[model samples]
Target: MSSPAPPSGAAPTPSLLRPWPQFLDLSALSLPISLSEATYRLTQNLRYFLPNYVVITLLIFLVTLVSRPLSLILFLCIFAAWIYLVFLRDEPLTILDYDIDQKIILGLLAVMTLVALLWTKVWLKLLISLIIGAVIVLIHGILRAPEDSMEDSPYGSLLNVVDSPGGEHASV
Candidate 1:
């Protein structure tokens, strides 16, 4: 026999096995308007936003990796600032005889990241890594030979020139 239908105007009871129906309402989690509309907007503009977000995230990761020690110090300072602002509210936050506020804490973190990037030479490290990767790729390509003759292969002449002594003067 089929179960009785729910009373009119009452929400249908969700099954215990499918609890997500009760808790994960997309409409409830929407910003100001409809969740579907917001999602549509994001999808429509993804091509414009994704590449910039990826580049910025990669740059931040590189800077953080290069400035490991200083980043740790900066993290600790931010943590201390948080602790002072939230946990130890009874005491005023003071640094170097000046009162420290949210703006000051944020400014300090920004300055620290900038200083760390400069001090660690993140740009120089990035350039070196790129050069090394290119060199490795080139070396691998040069060492791997094709079955075709030097004249038939596209890179054959270039490889021969590089491998041969006094072949620098060879015409293109």
Candidate 2:
């Protein structure tokens, strides 16, 4: 037997359990536009603020080169930058700046992770994590750059591209 048709001008009944529309919306979390925007903004900042990257890298290297207090200070600096970008930035969450400063902090964690692998030194893991994070950022930067663009940026080298609106190098 076939089900009865709905009455004229009456809405159709929705499933008592899960509804199709709700399910589709929930499953759309992996949308590409959001991911690509995130990639663009992230690489933009990383390519722009490479000194911050170097500073963090050197700091981690120093941690390996020196003692504990210096490492903590360097890590704190990295963390402070992250708070600024993630909390204070006006851009939409999906398209916020790439902010490699935070990655530097994570890289330190990676370093610590690396050390942990060789030994039980928890601090060393920071360095290991830092290295891995750097590799990821580098890959993202390369992928984000346009193929036919000559001279990535006028301000700095190919790796760093801080371009001003008037066609000049703004700053590093």
Candidate 3:
């Protein structure tokens, strides 16, 4: 079965999933001419599409964990800790009157998360998925040409692309 075609005059609306439809423009994708060019394009694309890359990596990790219930629970606990201590915290935390540094919390969380995930034995699968995601992002970043048509803009970047009329530069 297939859906009916749209009217000829209608400019088909872009999918909500693709905030910036132009970001995935195939015509803009091409092989870099030189090592320097590749490096430059990779850096630029990575910067510009960092949010998109993050989502891809997250999706990969989530998929890897779906088959392992225990790992999923452990991952959620670790993620909650990070979110509570870092992103959601409005001020420095105090333990026994001595203030705890955010950096220390981050370090400890990183070490603990690694140890816990590794101990779960599912780390291998998650790690491989993450690496694959990184590779895909890197390849695309290197190949996607720097768009000449897009202009620099400060608003509607990353997750806020739809907020502005034309968020040309989601990243610099």
Candidate 4:
């Protein structure tokens, strides 16, 4: 049999599972008048209040300082700077438009190239490793077939590095 309703002027018991009935209301939000406003507020806060570029640079610097040797700190710092510049800062003059995946691959290739150049005892091996890194980078670009593929020159940059007698200025 069904139970009787609550007595007059008496409040009904609240459910434990569905506590905080006001949580369902959309108008109860205090911050962010709208979606665009929220985004603008966050961006503005970061731009004015937070010094992200300096923080990343300082972290990298500290990591490099406390470490025993400067083997990978330089690479780490460059990678961190790349991340901050690519994702956070909106300065078009100092920004790079490369995709995140492409940037990661390029960063790895850069680290490998640097290591190969430094750790190698002979010049020929370093050259070979640099060429291999370049080939891998190019292959990634071809496989992905990105919108910026045309910007990357196949025979120009790759060939210049592969054919250069000495380890020239190869910015991968």
Off by over 4 Å in 4: 1-69, 91-129, 143-172
Model 1 misplaced regions, further than 4 Å: 1-92, 95-98, 123-172
TM-scores of all candidate predictions against the true structure? 0.26, 0.25, 0.58, 0.22
The lDDT, on a scale of 0 to 1, for candidate 1 is 0.47
Q: Write the per-residue lDDT of candidate 2 for residues 19-73, one digit (tens) a residue.
A: 3343224333332234554465456546444544454454555455345555455
Model 4 TM-score on a 0 to 1 scale? 0.22
lDDT of 4 at 17: 18
lDDT of 3 by residue, 1-172 (tens): 3457779997534222234566778888988767867777888777667766766776688688888888888877887787678756666888998989988998999998889877988767877988999899989888888763133222214325565568556475
Model 2 Cα shift for residue 40 (angstroms): 0.4
lDDT of 4 by residue, 55-78 (tens): 433344345434334534554555
Winner of 3 and 4 under TM-score: 3
What value does the lDDT take at residue 172 in candidate 2?
85
Cα lDDT tens digits for candidate 1, 1-172: 3446768998433211223332233433323133443444344323223333333334444455555666556545644554446444543566898766756666776676566557656655556655654454333223323223245444557758878877868377
